[model samples]
Target: MVIRLLREQEEETENRGKKGPFFLLIFIIVFLSIFAFVFPFFFGFLYILGFQKVMGCFPCTGQSKKRTESGVNNDIKRKDQKKPTSGSLKVNSNGNLQKEDAAKDDRLSLDARNSNLKDQISENEINGGTKFAFGELVEATDNFSSNCFLGEGGFGKVYKGHLKRLNQVVAIKQLDQNGVQGIREFVVEIVMLSQADHPNLVKLIGYCVEGDQRLLVYEYMPLGSLENHLHDLPPGQKPLDWNTRMRIAAGAAKGLEYLHDKMNPSVIYRDLKCSNILLGEGYHAKLSDFGLAKVGPIGDKTHVSTRVMGTYGYCAPDYAMTGQLTFKSDIYSFGVAFLELITGRKAIVQTKDRGELYLVAWARPMFKDRKNFSRMVDPLLQGQYPSRGLYQALAIAAMCVQEQPTMRPAISDVVMALNYLASQNYDPQTHLAQGPCGSPSRTGAKRDNDKAQIASDGSVRD
Candidate 1:
């Protein structure tokens, strides 16, 4: 019984040892499982806390807040800056944006000014001229058709159009956007022509200003410009006779006289060339193209200071050199035009001979001698002009193109001389009766002697 009890005790001790190992294995397994699940979450929490602490310690958070605030302020500033006013913006932050804003402001200002001009036109402040619509002009010109094209000038292309509404034929000058003349010139022309009323001046019939299009309407000159008649005469066309030439010169001078003496403030005809002198039905000469006209200096001022602007050959030397424009400047240009009429040569001719290139330069030498006077007459005249008449005409042209502005004759004096010449009608029949050697007949000799006596008596000179 004692051996059996001892064996039971040993079995019980082995069982106890197995139970203790099993309990230990189960406890280790539970602890490992808990560590696997909880370790990741605890590490993540610690990592998040460290990341927050690092971000909080740096100044980037304040910088990010500032960037957001700056963006909002810029948005508010841009919205505030869009208001249009007379004063331009002064912004240092952005250059490209400032330029864009300035451009918008300029466009707005231009639109406002244009609106005012349109209102003035509607009120008839632009004289009795009509304000035409853009579409009307387009239709009248047949969409600026090539068939209706009359000519082109510095201003733009001209087209002959029949105004269906007014039952009037008109000459439409469409301004070139890329031309030297712009909105300022266009407005100046309208203002100048509207205030001027004279038979010797081309009438301003109407005008059109629409968006980018600018146009002027005038009474259609049937004979076109004097340049057409004088230079490049078409085939089988007759040259102007002595009387006709004198008449045109007198009329043009009278136009200048009216501008200088009649207008309240004298108007300076800055542009006076053959092309600007338009001929009417009876070859009546009238001054056109007042875009370059300027108001003369008032009171004691002797000359107007302006940028030198005119045809090169026709511009007065003093005006061209000094930019000091005077009424005598017009006189000088008139002298050039008269020279063109007398010689049928261009103001600046293109020829192989350098001596004959400039009409004034060529005529200056001829003016010094009486014998060269006949040579200066238009070869087209074929010696049909009278000797004394030629001398008197050259004298007038000579005094006109004097180097010194003070030496040039006034427009009134020029008018008197040209009027006398225009009245002394030249009979081509009487001219033809003279022999081939050009010996003066008794009547012709007597008439020449009388004219010489009269010219000597200061009728032509004064």
Candidate 2:
């Protein structure tokens, strides 16, 4: 034929160029499997429209009104520039709008220092305090009524009202909106009980605050808390007498010697315990909670580092292992509240008798024995104390629980040794007519003239 019909047209043009690259490799494997399944839903819809246009959440049109008028002209050129001072920081470029403008300038400087703390307690005129009206303490606490409560703590509840607009009888308190005290311990217990005068200290006659309420008032007391006449004594009550527990331990050491030698920046009460002392009609004592008062280390600056806080068997083991504090950390929480008025005991107790769970480690081995000082008194004072005034009040509560805070003493020498043991009045019928062998060498020369007038007055050494 023509050359075998031109060899069947050159084998049909080499099988049409090998079936055109096998249909171009099956359309590039179905366009790379539909671009790896629509490239992650179009890059997650352009990363949710660039995170909703960098969080402004873009909805206002005209290009977000020209980007909110160029962010209000860059916040009026950053309020005409030179700003960042309060100890400077200011770095921006949107780190979540610089932490929402540093939490709106710390809530507008803590609402301008809580609106200048009621004009700094009305320009510090404080004395018998005032500022009432939170509807006159809700009509003098009748509203807080549960039969006008009168107890509850950690910074809340207490009641006993009757203030028909200062017709008197106060004591309110309130606070506790999830308590542990706040609003900086209700402005430090109204600026430390309004310039703390002191019949042993608790008076602040008024306070309220209103919106988000607070309250305070005071003056009522009527025989309460010296941990209610020393550790749970209700059923037949009475127990406080050993000359009213050495006159409420010499009026709680003259309210810690008027806050460590009459305050003028000496006040470190920092929550001394025994339910913050209190008591009133006749069993007088006072020092009521100045919400962890602090201000001590003035001038020479011996301590006040701070942040330890108190009451765990009454703190001070070197201010709870070095937070520093001082004024002997309120004389080791007034020697664990004068050893809970000489062992009516309960400064952390839970005893199956394994070395008696801490009342200053069970009075530190009964203060190295003076016949274990009548077995550490307060067996409800049945021996009617005065075994030489219970060995000089357990040697001034063993020099105010000294694990050496410069060996404790000085709250004006624990108010001159508990005001000479509350003027020595223990007449158990003149100590049973001076019976236990009355004049042992004129009672050992009046116990060496009462330890040389308590070591010449500034006692508490060892």
Candidate 3:
């Protein structure tokens, strides 16, 4: 009995020893789990203190203090430390914030060097003749970058610029120094624009005459020239609608009327073409590039004799043959532009109907036959114009392009006619059902309207 009790006690002691290791293992696991969970937060707190020390001091976090009080002075200090790479920021002339970096590039001075040229243009010639520095123009045009270049005109290269001082976008015409003719035009434009201010006329904002550089600045017209919309349209562009065309014509005529009748001396627009007529927003047209403008004959005189200069197909028959220029010559040119608008063809097109290369010649026969009036309308119009309106427009264009300048209607008369035409209503939904020639249930009309409709993005829709 004594031996059995001793064996049983030994067995119990062995089981207790085994159970001790298991409890120690469990204790170690619990300690490791607790340390793993709390270590992240403890390390984060230490790192934040080290960050505060590295950054000089801890930012105040108090509800009582104003929200901006802590960083107000700090931000200003940081800004002062950093040197500006462009120019100092300041409120511009138009109450807009912009960099005035042009001052750094103002290297040319107009004192004594071009005294003779300066004398030609007296201070009294114009009240406050805003003379822009060459540096300002250079900076505005980004040193006349190719991308900003608008086009090559009769004067020189034109660049679209943003004048920081004026806080406005403007078109800058820089003269070609090598061309002596450009110099005369530069002076003429500056003098003419200085005195003339009308809604239809392009406003010359300022001019730059530093050293050999001669630049004329004018307001930017976003829609570009009328010629651009008329010819060589880029892909995905719709043709100008008939109503828009009439409005442009009327607006342009008003500009000529302002120059011809409203001005005291009665200025004549010697150069009148689609290219010279610039369009603005909503296709509002304005006459531009007045380098070739000449004062009309005074009083009883009929014409002014000058060198023959203007676009080919647009010049009047009388002016082209003889150098005698009259207000009638401009009327003839306007007729050509009117014809182009009607035909949706250029005044001078290449290899187009061999003998009918000139739009005026091709349209002449069509005008003679009343039934052929529909043929003159632009196919791009998709037969959307009123028949009577089209006839009236064609009649006006025909009279303006008469072989005799005497037969041509005055610009005022033309304006009156176009104003009536522009007022005519057009219903595209109703017109689309008819043919291009206004004949009902015609397959040809439906086909043409369908093609134009597919290509049209509501540019012609009223």
Candidate 4:
């Protein structure tokens, strides 16, 4: 230690006495240190401060940082949001990027979202988002009371919450966070799920990722999922008319097509089912619940290889047998969902004499025969749909359920076909051509109530 200290002292003394190259070298080293270690931060600070002052001169929006709204924007805020995309990169007169000045503001937004996710992670582990606080969620949800609860699923429960900041109502999905799938699901959502932009796909808002509680917040869907509307919900809700059913089918196809074609790597919704399809306030259909969604195969690779994952009854046969998932597999599942929408019966059910009755097995054969196809429409739909349209929809559904995924129509094709069905102008008077249902005395009605039910409008009674 003494030798090292003496060496340093001699070097300092030698440098102090030197007037030529040694002193010049010392001067260069000190100057280099100022530029390397100090100048940027020192100058950058002043630059940002000056930039902020300049930015402060701009109009201050009356909208508070803690704004909240439903999916719909209030009239005033919507007006303010409509800014002209002026072809200008915001910069200060000193040539510094304005983004730096607003770094603090951006951080505050991300921080609030992150905080919300953290607070809800304990009770639901769903990795919702952190913008909201535990107290905020309690206040929003009324402390997750029974009334705020929306629905329960295999993963966890969902609650309706109102965020004062965004002035928006959102669905908070609280999911189990311990399993491998749970964490993967969180990462998948954080990485891929977003606006999804397709008319048929659902919108995902921010998420929560605090501690052990995982929650996913989404735009509140007023009408809920087709699964509950068809079979589970209380009787108070209006029955899904034929037009509503067709619209749902068409819209869902459009969503799937957008994901398959427009998204960066293309996405495959592995789990497609009625339960995952949500309806907006106006009853437009949007496919939601992307926990099992995956990016499709990239260049040169025929398909992605992974362990099989998806619900039972809705899975395509080939996809189930092999761990291979493709876009067509999703279409196949759509076929099953189509049958569910048409028949109003559970996809898989086991009964006494009929050991096991799966919709695909029974509908496949019956759908081949026109008489049988007409017989399969839901009793609720009572011949309201045009027969030709029904035939086309059924044919598309049949094509989707083909044993080979490659043979199935692309979601785009399915979307187009369903769209045609949705647009068909089936006159209500056509039902009168089939006969009466209330008074059984008239045998003119095509068949019994047991026949695939038909609604007043011409849709897939089947």
Provide the TM-score for each candidate, comma-separated: 0.70, 0.35, 0.68, 0.66
User: Candidate 2 has which clashing residue pairs, if any?
Assistant: 150-159
Most lDDT-accurate candidate: 1
lDDT of each: 0.81, 0.72, 0.76, 0.69
What's the true lDDT of residue 345 in model 3? 87
- Which structure is stronger by TM-score: 2 or 4? 4
Which portions of model 4 miss their true places by more than 4 Å? 1-130, 178-181, 430-462
lDDT, ranked from best to worst: 1, 3, 2, 4
Task: State the lDDT of candidate 4 residue by residue for 360-424, as single tens digits.
Answer: 88877675445565667776665565555556666777778877777777787787888888997
Candidates in descending TM-score order: 1, 3, 4, 2
lDDT of 1 by residue, 1-462 (tens): 999999999999999998998999999999999999999999999997887787676454443667758766777877877762332455566542343454434332343356455442322333426878889988898999999999998899999998898988999999998998777677768877888999999999988866688899999999999999888888999999888999999999999999999986789999999999999999999999998898898899999999999997899999999999999999999999999999898999777856447788888866654445556777777767776677788778888888899888899999999999999999978654222333454444543532332132122432
TM-score (C-alpha) between model 4 and the true structure: 0.66
Tell me, by TM-score, which candidate is best.
1
Worst 10 residues of 2 by lDDT: 448-457
Clashing pairs in 3: none
lDDT of 3 by residue, 1-462 (tens): 999999999999999999999999999999999999999999999997886576555365443446547666766755764643222445568874445565542222222113334444443443315779899999999999998999887688889999999899999999886743466566667667778888888888888867678888999999989989888889999888877988898888889988888887788788889989998888888898887788899978999998997878988889989999999998888888988887788888778447537787787766655546566777787777766666667777888888887878888998888888787756666665335455544554433222111001101111
User: Over 4 Å off in model 1, which ranges?
Assistant: 1-128, 353-356, 432-462
Residue 40 of candidate 3: its Cα lDDT?
99
